[model samples]
Structure formats: C-alpha cells, structure tokens
Target: MAKYNDKELAETSKFLSFVLRHKPEAIGIVLDREGWADIDKLILCAQKAGKRLTRALLDIVVATSDKKRFSYSSDGTCIRAVQGHLTSQVAIGFIEKTPPQFLYHGTASRFLDEIKNKG
Candidate 1:
C-alpha cells in the first residue's frame, strides 16, 4: 500500500504553510485578499520551486496537519493557512469570528464554501 509517513506529511505541511501564508512568491503564486491561493496554481508553483507537490499530496497534508492549519475553498480550487500569514501581503480577514484561539480564523462565512472551516 502507498501512504505518506509522518516525516513526509510534516515536510509537506511546512511547505504548504510557507506558500499558503508568508511567501507565495517562493513558488511564484499569488494569494487573494483573504490569503487564499489557487490550489492548481499552488501545485504548479511548488513544482517550479522544486517541490514534488500534487493535489492528492496537498489534500493529505491539509488533512493530517495537527494544527488544522490549511483549508480549501468551497469549490476546492483554492487553499489558505488558518493563521500565521502576518508577513504576507494579503492579510486574512477574521471579522465577527468565534473568539478564543480562532484556529480557523479569517474564514469568512460567505467564503465558507470556498474556504472551509475545519475544527
């Protein structure tokens, strides 16, 4: 059976965190105002940046991340980190959100379809 181990999963998580949050430029991608980036574009950029990334792998990374950091757009075409994008050009919006360590913070309800809020 083919499956990703902890090291691979953690590595991918870090990579995703970097691209989805602080430096989309690392892979030559752009994030929207809400810190969401196109999943397809993210894959392509990661490839360009010398990372062997794929949609499947990305899904696994997002799923297995302990912090529940990343989320997919409603259409599943885009993704973003829950927080820690402070150094990013696009600041994630989190208005009228559930307080107390909003792990899924900035995920606007309107975009909930696009950017899901995972607990």
Candidate 2:
C-alpha cells in the first residue's frame, strides 16, 4: 500500500466529502440516487479539475476516517459517503424502526437547554 501523509489524507478526505456529499457537478461527475459514484470516473474528473486522486488514497481515507464517513460497494468498484449529504438529489435508503429503550444523540453544548426543555 502507498503511504499518505496527514496533509494528503486530510485534503483527500475533504475533497471526497465535497464531491460525494455536496456538489459532484463541481467535477463534472454525477452521483447515483443512492449517492454512489463510479470510482474511476471520479478519479478522471478530479484529475481534470486539477486534483490528484487514486484508488489507494480513497481506500486509505475510507479506512482511516474516524467518523467512518465513506463506504465502498460490495464489489469495491464504487464509493459513497456514509451520511451528511447536503444535496437533495440523493435518497439514502434508511430503514425506519422503533427506537431502542436507550438511544444517544450528540449535539453541541448550546443545544442542551433546548433539548432538555423540548425533548
């Protein structure tokens, strides 16, 4: 595996988040309704846009992200953000289910009073 430094990894992670979650059109690529993008097409488009990208770097980002923000297809040919999409085009398939007895939600400290009063 090719080694990547922190700067390379951070930059690539930001790039992936932008293209996969927000504006894929910025690179002239389209994500599927499920937000998956063809890895090869993404690489080409990003290169054309003056960004360096590769499968190895993508693998590193997906594997090392603390948030686990991206995932690969079953056959490893496609990739997508796990969540946090700002675009309305993606219809992420989420299953609705009854909440567990104990569920945790993370929020900023400023929201604590509002949550306590409203929740």
Candidate 3:
C-alpha cells in the first residue's frame, strides 16, 4: 500500500465527497439512487474534471479514511461516499439509532437542517 500524508488524504477525501456524494454531475458521472457510481466512469469523469483519481488512490482513500466515508460495490465495479448526498438520488439504508447523537454529517451546510429534520 502507498503511504499518503494527512494533507493528501484530506484533499482526496474532499474530492471524493464532491464527486461521489454531492455533485457527480460536476464531472459528468452518474450516481445511482443508492449512490453507487461506476468506478471506471468515475475515473474518466474525474480526469475530465481535472482530478487524478486512480483506482489505487480510490482504494487507499477508502481504506485510510478515519470516518469510513466511502464504500465499494459487491462486485467492486462501483464506488460511493457513504454519506453526504445533495440530492434525493441516494437512498443509503439508515436504521434508527438511539438518541440520534451520532447521525449523518452532510457535505454542504444547507443539508444540516434536512438531516436534522429527517433523522
């Protein structure tokens, strides 16, 4: 595994959140209703968006993220950020938790209210 410094990880995480969770259309990639995006398409779109998101980097990001932000599909052909959806497109299954102390932390500030209301 390649070692990534804190800054590199942060930048990559931010980029993934933007592309996977919030605005995949920003890079012309499509995320399904469950937030799954084709890994190959994600790479191509990210390159078009001027971001170098290699498969190796994606794996590293998914592995190293402290918050466990991203995930892969069962066949490993898809990827998605675990949270922070800007649209209703993603429907990640969420079970009710106790007290609601720990809940979704959205990517944008505008989503905070919606999360609070929905959760």
Candidate 4:
C-alpha cells in the first residue's frame, strides 16, 4: 500500500466527493442505480481525469472521513456516498417516513422567511 500525507488524503477525498456524490461522468464512469461504483473502475477513471486515486488512498479516505460520507459495499468491491446524491442518477433505498408535526431547523436569519414559506 502506498503511504499518503494529510494533503494528499484531503485532496483525494475532495475529488471523491466530486465524482462519487456529484458527477461520476466527469471521469467517464457511471455509478450503479444504488450509487455504487466499482472501486477499480473508479480508480482508473479518476486517473484518466487527471486525478490520482489508488485503492490504498481510497481506503484511507473512507476510514478517516469525519462525517462518514462514503461507504463500501459489503463485499468491498464497490463504493458510494452515504447520502447527498443526485436523485436522478442514484436511487438509494431510503426508508420513507412521515414528517414530524413540528421540526426545528437551523439557518441564518436571512433565509428564515424562505424556509417558513417553503415549509
């Protein structure tokens, strides 16, 4: 396994966020319906996009993320974001639940009116 520094890890993590959460197509790869992508293919496609990615770095990133943003498949052959996916592409099986009667939201005062209106 290749050793990587904090900067390398952070940069790779951001790149992962871009491709995995937002635009897999940016690297000429497609995520599955559940948003999982083949880890090997992800590494290759990221290299083609001028980003350096390796299985080792990927492992570190997934292990170190403070927000628990990414997840590996049970078999460890695939990966996906835990949430924050574009619904058009990734149909993660989220459980449906009714909204609570009252909910507290945190936001800047400037956005309160909009939130009230939308809510």
Listed in order, each prediction's TM-score against the native is: 0.75, 0.89, 0.73, 0.78
TM-score comparison, 1 vs 3, better candidate: 1
Model 1: CA > 4 A from native: 97-119
Off by over 4 Å in 3: 1-3, 95-119
Model 1 per-residue lDDT at 112: 77
Q: Write the per-residue lDDT of candidate 2 for residues 1-119, one digit (tens) a residue.
A: 78899999999999999999999999998888899999999999999999989888998999999999999999998999999999887999999999999999999999999999998
Which one is best on TM-score? Answer: 2
lDDT of 2: 0.93
Candidate 3: C-alpha RMSD after superposition: 6.8
> What lDDT score is found at residue 9 in candidate 4?
87
lDDT order of candidates, best first?
Answer: 2, 4, 3, 1
lDDT of each: 0.81, 0.93, 0.84, 0.88
Tell me the deviation in Å of residue 38 in model 3. 0.4
Clashing pairs in 4: none
Candidate 4: which stretches are off by over 4 Å? 97-119
- Candidate 3: worst-modelled 10 consecutive residues by lDDT: 97-106
Candidate 2 — which residues are off by over 4 angstroms? 106-111
Q: Which ten residues in a row have the lowest lDDT in candidate 1?
A: 97-106
TM-score head-to-head 1 vs 4, winner: 4
In the predicted model 2, the residue pairs found to clash are none
Rank order by TM-score, top first? 2, 4, 1, 3
Count backbone clashes in candidate 1: 3
Q: How accurate is candidate 4 locally (lDDT)?
A: 0.88
